[model samples]
Target chain A: MIEIKDLQKNFGDTKALKGVNLTVPDGELFAYLGPNGAGKSTTIRILTGLTKISKGRARLGGYDIEKEPRAAKRQFGVVHQHVNLDPELTVFENLDIHGQLFGMSKAARRARIKELLDYIELTGRAATLIKQLSGGLKRRVTIARALLHEPGIIFLDEPTVGLDAAIRRRIWALIKKIQLRGTTVFLTTHYIEEAEFLADRVAFLDKGRIIALDTPANLMAMAGAWAIDQFKDSGMQTHYFKDRKQAAAFQTDDSFTLRRVNLEDAFLSLTGKKVQP
Target chain B: MINECLAIYRREMLILKRRLIRQMAGQAVSPLLYLVTFGYAMGDKIRFDGISYLDFLLPGLVAMSSMTRSFAIATDINVARFYWHIFDEFQAAPISNVSYVAGEVLAGMTRALMGIIIILGLGLLFGVHLAYGPMFWLPILLNSFLFASLAVALAMLVKNHADQSLLVNFVITPMAFLGGTFFPIARLPGWLQSILKLLPLTHASKAIRQAALGKPVNLHSLALLAALGAVIFLIALGCVNRARD
Candidate 1:
């Protein structure tokens, strides 16, 4: 479980986060959605003990992040938004070192690393240097490295940011597989479909505060079930209706295209802005 | 705490092991050049305090290499920080700041020891034998410890690779020559010697040479080196702690 209360972050005169509060239950795949500069990374950094918390309290698996940093850190593994693995080290060595840092025994580290290699489908590539791996392969190894110590929760900051759709789906499967094994997952991503598809619950964060939080279906339902996008001289305007019949009736010209409302549409309706813009 | 430190040290040693030959060869080139040019060219004509120039120059080289080799850990730290992002992994791990500093310092000292051994072996091949006991090695260990701690502190403070290189040029390079490696500090004017004595390496060279020459060990220099090493190691711990935030 993860608990956060009145989280606030300030950078000089700039207020990056403003009294954000959230809680994630165990075994929940929670996706935090936000645009750029929304204090997403800052929140992750604070929770992971990489940055100091300016205000409020946070706990990971009952361990207070500030007062008990090492315990809090041990409770959760983090896959950073960037690839932070050692390029000079082979996959096995990278995982081995992480296990060592956690104070795992030599025999335990070997067994766990081998199991994680198989888990991430990189079993045969253990000897390959991180620099020699493809971007997708590197991301897989990064995930494997994070899971080496078997923490209760994992924080993944944009795990599939630049991968293709097919690769993203494969990663989503891996994430879902991990979650099914009972690890609470805190995910942040710009991919609305990803949040919609994989998240047990989604939180839409804008300018540091979460504007909405609920199950993906419930959040999307806030914008109605149907949407009709009409392109005009001014700009594109979206009209939402409770039913497909209402949406079809609302569209009168070739400029209008009717479709089901998506998580992005729900976010746009709530915040009047794009999630990625 | 010991386990975490060993983990960090093990990573550095693994990397060093992979490039062991390259590092060995790189370390050998400079001392060999010094031995051939300075030790061989001067031969028996230049004796400092009734000792052959090779004997005098050999211990000096040992002291100098210990300083340089340990200080060289800063470059590896910079590479890990700027390019590999390995430090980020460390930051996110469960390791404490003191453990991280201790581990890196140990690795730096290990590298210094390797360079010292290589110089000693070259000294044998050149037929120059000096004292090789605790009296000789204790100062070398202290010198390595002081410089390695300084390296870790500076590595944390440097912003980029260029800044790190500038530090080497302005700080390490000047100290290398002025700290009595090639010549005795007493050869300089009294006022200049006073300023040179302020350098940690000067004390290191003096004590190491005294011990290697089988002269009575300078307890004062050894005490200063130990004190300086402890202070710098504490500073390194503080720097690592600050960097973590």
Candidate 2:
């Protein structure tokens, strides 16, 4: 479980996070959705103790991140937004070092590394250097490394950002499997579909503030189940309807098309800005 | 904390093992050139404290190599921080700032020890032998500790690889040449001697050369080095903490 209260972060004259508050309960897969520079990574960094918070308090598994950093850090595994594995080291070596950093015994590290390599389905590539692996494989190895010490929570920041659609789905399945294992998962992403497909609850963050928070179905239903997009001389406009027949009836011109309302439409209807930059 | 430091230190040792041969070859080339061009060229023409020029140059080479090799950790730190982003891995882990700095300093010391062995081997081949005693290692270690601690502090302060290289050019290069590694500081002007004598490497060179030649070691220089190393190490710890923020 993670708890944040009135969190604020500032860099000189600019504020990165402004009086933001959030709580993620145990075993919940919560997605913090935002565009670029939307304070998603900043919140994660503050929670993980990577960056100092300018104001407010954060607790990870009941340990204060500022006052009890070591204990707080021991409670969570962080898969950073960027690839941070040692390139010269082998896959097993990377996991081994991480386990050792957590004070895991040698035998424990050996067993965990073996289990995780198999879990990530990289048993054959355990001996390969990180630089030798493909992008998707590297991402999997990073995730595996994060889980080596068996922390209670996992913070994944844009885990599948640049990966192809197929690889992204594979990661999505892995995330589901991780959540099923009873670990609380906190994920941040700009991809609307990722949040919709994987999260139990979603929070929309923009300009250092949380604008909307709810289940995917609830957020979509608040707008409508169906949508009609109409193109005019000025620009394209979309209208949401509760019924499929009504949405179809709203499409009068050849330029108009009827489709199901998605999380993106919910975000647009709520904030008047696209979820993706 | 000790276990965490060793974990980081062990990773560096493993990487060093893979590149051991190439590193040894690279370490040998520069000292060999200096020995041939400077050592052989002025073999008997120059004498310091009644010892041959080559003999006097041998210990200075050891001191210089130890300082440079230990200082090389800054480059490694910069690479880990900027390119590999490995420092972020450590930051997110449960390790303390002290553990990270201690681990890196030890790795630097190990590299310095390796360089000392290589230079001593080269000295034997060139027929320039000297005393290898406890006093010899004590000052060498203190010197390595000094530079390596400085290296970690500077690495934390630098913004990028280019900034790191600029630091080496401005700080380490001058100390290498003017710190009595290639020539005696006594030969310089009195005012310059006073300034160079303030350098930690100068005291390192003086103490190491004295211990090598069976001369009376200056306790003041050794004390100064120990004091400086301790202070710089604390500064490096502060820098590591600041860098994480």
Candidate 3:
């Protein structure tokens, strides 16, 4: 549903995206993982037509983002990394305006707004102003607004960045439900567990380049099944082992903790840096 | 594009609806104070162009109100861009740059018209009647368009609320005072008159006052305003395009 070919973006002397290429097939839940300033948002911005691409081509649902921006934009819904809803507008009004922008008829907008409010479990708060809502509720309303137009694809850029763990899981379930409904989902995040738990396939983006791309299980397996983490003068240093027995055999006088290898370990093994900076 | 523009315009109208009472009160209070303080004090004392001072000031007040209210959209734009981040939502949507600019400019114009109506009503309350004709609205709209377009362009360039206020203090406030709004431009020296004549609001005041006093409408002023509006609107479009990049 989304195709990016040799995409490059530059801001003067700094390159935000360096010849990155990616393709997310229909109904796939793909996560673009990276640290701060790692080009995850830049890639999403290019795909959503929010920012211009310096080179190469990006297509959304077969429409070129540069040459056919309107049509391309019509094919996808974008939930930006930052909250962008009109604070003075009611929840329903926010969704209503979005539907209208996409040219939905009055009856259609009403029906969609009702359906989305219900879907996001915010029907009771439909008439409430966005500023009155809590952070998690605001995030849900933003998600609902993005889905109002019923686009074929959705780009969620750090959708649950600052939310608490419980709220984050709720959003994760919502995202999974969206994928189950047959919409192609493209998510970007620095949270390793979010990508592991929600994404079908994950791509590691470091310094504007895709360093690793694979399924969570495959990526973890390549890094090893078990990890021994020991606190050092520098920081927490983790050593990977093929199995529990191997990890058990490797011992040190310093205190250590044994845990399962996660996406973070895979990223650290690939790029030698933590995902959170 | 038209539909998208209307959608944005409708959203602004909705916000305006919620704040209608406060907005009208704010709009009404300023002109009323001007009419009471200036109109009553100078009604019998001063005369210009063979009319009462109160009569001469009505059209100028109307012209000034329209300019100030229309240009007030810069504050709204800045709030949306900075505080609310609502511009990003529009950016990611399927709307065209032209549609966004058209919608905002129209919203500003609507605010200007609303201000004009309030001021006109105040004039009626004070027993100051002027000609209400088609010529009156033409220059009013042209003036609103000119300032609204300029507001959009400047809104894009301002970095924050401080910068926006700086723009008002340095650019809009001076124009409001000196743009033939409160007095006749002919009273100024020749050089200052030439410079003030270059302002769109000056032409707007000239045309509106002429129409109000039963003088023949100055097509030259209307034409000048229309030309300035068109040029500034194109500049606003360019600013919108550049801002997205």
Give the alpha-carbon lDDT of every model. Answer: 0.91, 0.92, 0.91
Q: List the candidates' TM-scores in order.
A: 0.96, 0.98, 0.97
Indicate the residue-level lDDT of B104 in model 3. Answer: 91
Backbone clash pairs for candidate 1 read: none
DockQ of 3: 0.79
Residue A255 lDDT in model 3?
80
- Kindly give the stretch of ten consecutive residues in candidate 1 chain A with the minimal lDDT sum: A45-54
Question: Candidate 2: deviation at residue B74, Å?
Answer: 0.8
Task: For residues B81-193, write the lDDT of model 3, one tens digit per residue.
Answer: 88888888888888887888888999999999999999999999888988989998889999999999999999988778899999899988898899998889899999999
Docking class of 3: medium
Q: State candidate 2's DockQ.
A: 0.82
Interface RMSD of each: 1.4, 1.1, 1.1
Give the runs in model 1 whose Cα sits over 4 Å from its true position. Answer: A233-235, B42-45
Off by over 4 Å in 3: A252-254
Name the lDDT value of residue B4 in candidate 2.
Answer: 98
Per-residue lDDT of model 1, residues A33-144, tens digit only: 9888988888898888887778999999999988988898899889988888878789999999999999999999999988998898887888998889988888988888
**In model 2, which regions exceed 4 Å deviation?**
A232-234
